[model samples]
Target chain A: MGNVAYAVLSSDEQEVSIMEKKIQWETELVHALQRSKVEKRPILLDFHNPH
Target chain B: MDTVTYPQQSVVTFIEHNLIPLRVGSDTQPLASDFAVTWTPTLVLLDPQGKEHHRTVGFFDAEALIPSLLLGLGKVEYDSNKFKEALGYLEKLLAEYPESDSAPEAIFLTGVNRYKSTGNPLPLKEAYEQLQRMYPASTWTKRAYPYRLLG
Candidate 1:
């Protein structure tokens, strides 16, 4: 989960929140990809609901 | 999936801690004057000699962003018409996801395309100002100012 690099250039804490969300999304993406690989199906990625 | 390269190697140096390229510097100083520095992410495009090319500040959706970065880096043949079409898709995405992380950039691109198409500048200024007011602390606001007010 922490392996992916989160890149940002802002000092605002709000941006940090964004990064957190991005990280969560990336984690979900990886999980979904893993599941898809096991199931042998293409996974759909949606921003609204990662689960 | 296409590969593109700049005349020179460009870098997206993440200024914030914990981000990729994890670099640190004085908060008081400009990160790159010689290379085009985009904010919120500070993506820099450089010439062969490492001179500034173009800068953008804000997060871009896959539609508008992927192409814009490719064109800026001289990675592929960019058709302005194709980019305009892509901007339409980005605008719709913003309308659907107004609070998405990429919203501000979509707003900026809308105004930018409008201004470019009609030369009104009013829409562009208004859009840029919206970003400034909404995301006051955003580093992107700094770049939007000169374009919104002066040019």
Candidate 2:
């Protein structure tokens, strides 16, 4: 059953990676804008109350 | 947003693929005033050049967010004179999420693109009809009211 255990661990790792792929929020608006200019991607600015 | 909406896989994936996601607090400097954000949870989509394309004030589930962003992207393309590409995104948004908040805007822009492309009033008439039928009370329908006079 050693192979089975390894398979289960691999599946968990893959799931973790997928979760990690979720959008990373960049806090610095200026830096994000700069990156957007460099990357040629539109900016999705989410303004919200943290409280 | 962090606890509910933004964490959704589809929302995250779409944003990461199509946008440079930035989170700013309401109190954040010049950016907030520049964007004219008067409420919390105002999601603004801007072109790479920093022009505001679309803004929605409130929380949006993944289902709602994607189409709104697509509409903004479509407008950016439209503003850049990429009519065909803009239509592609707008049409997709309408097809996939006709019930979305952005649907009216997409419908309106689709007609504008069609008119820009062929210089014909038929598409605009059809768009006007669709808007009247689907969202008669929406501001988009009101905005498109003049198109009815074209034919």
Candidate 3:
């Protein structure tokens, strides 16, 4: 039982680590544009299909 | 892009450090029309004032994407009259990823920036020769055809 529990915890930790590597995309274009202007950074607009 | 490209460490770090990344649906309003994005998964890089400097359609892997983004950043600087800064980015792309999809464009633009800054046609001539030698069949080589007449 302890061994099974350890395996589950390891799996969960691996899942979390994978999730953490994904990019956190900003959803609001207006806000992103404003922030980019303020931050003096270029805006990378990604037009993607939700479907 | 999310599952394959964006998850790469180098791509994520580059975007985070140099760009304000925004993801929107293709159907998103005036912004989509403003950029004339007719295709899904189109990536457009805009200057701070919302002027577009570069765009690419379709999906790209991390290796292809980085050089493209770097070229866009170089164009942004070039459009802003920062020729020296633009050359720095373009030269770096050429040095590191000479075979990248964006490399031909970077090489072409390096010549343009050099000519613009130094008022010498030699760089343009060299660019034309390089493009002809390295990417004979590429459209970039065709675009540099006019430079051949400069001699």
Candidate 4:
């Protein structure tokens, strides 16, 4: 949620975006999918009981 | 999960580096029903287009979780027919976390991916042999049981 940080993996531009100090987890699927597409990364969708 | 697993430094870094994370309650409408999730702590890996490639129902510690995610990433690539990319992730998982519970399945997928990419049955045979020798009790070994005849 803060400044977006990035680390380059190689010259082929396999750069990865680094999250904030803590994981900035999106609560909605639509938004997360948007980020997934933009970031070109997979989505780790987690479902918890929330009890 | 919230208190224990997510806060781990390694997990945080790994997720930050490789994945887009979405957190939802099991009761969240439509989403939960769409995914057919009947249990808590279920983790699913989806491609950028939102197609699910891998999923696990249960909890995992930091040690086990990373390899599982790698496997999921490999599956995502595999689903897209990017066998070489998938193999990269699988190879990383096997090399780095060989002892993790996800290892057997990684070995299984590695074999399948190798076969898919190379059209050669030898890798399948090798995968079965490796699984038999290293993880004889693993269900993955049994799943690859038929590959023993691929000589």
Top of the candidates by DockQ = 3
- Per-residue CA lDDT of model 4 for B1-151, tens digit only, reads 7787898878999998999999999999999999999998999999878889999999899989999999999999998889999999999999999999999999999999999988998999999999999999999999999999996
Candidates 1 and 4 compared: the better one by DockQ is 4
Interface RMSD of each: 16.4, 1.3, 1.3, 1.4
Supply candidate 3's per-residue lDDT for B11.
94
Stretches off by above 4 angstroms in model 2 are A1-20
lDDT of 3 at B22: 91
Each prediction's DockQ against the real complex:
0.02, 0.59, 0.70, 0.53
- Compose the digit string of candidate 1's lDDT tens values, residues B9-101: 121211111111112121312333322222334443333222333445544444444344433432111123334654655555556556555
Tell me the TM-score of each prediction against the true structure.
0.35, 0.85, 0.89, 0.88
Report the Cα lDDT for candidate 2.
Answer: 0.87
lDDT, residue A27, candidate 3: 90
Identify the candidate with maximal TM-score.
3
Best by lDDT: 4
Ranking the candidates on DockQ from highest down gives 3, 2, 4, 1
* Fraction of native A-B contacts kept, per candidate: 0.00, 0.86, 0.86, 0.91
Second chain TM-score for model 1: 0.43
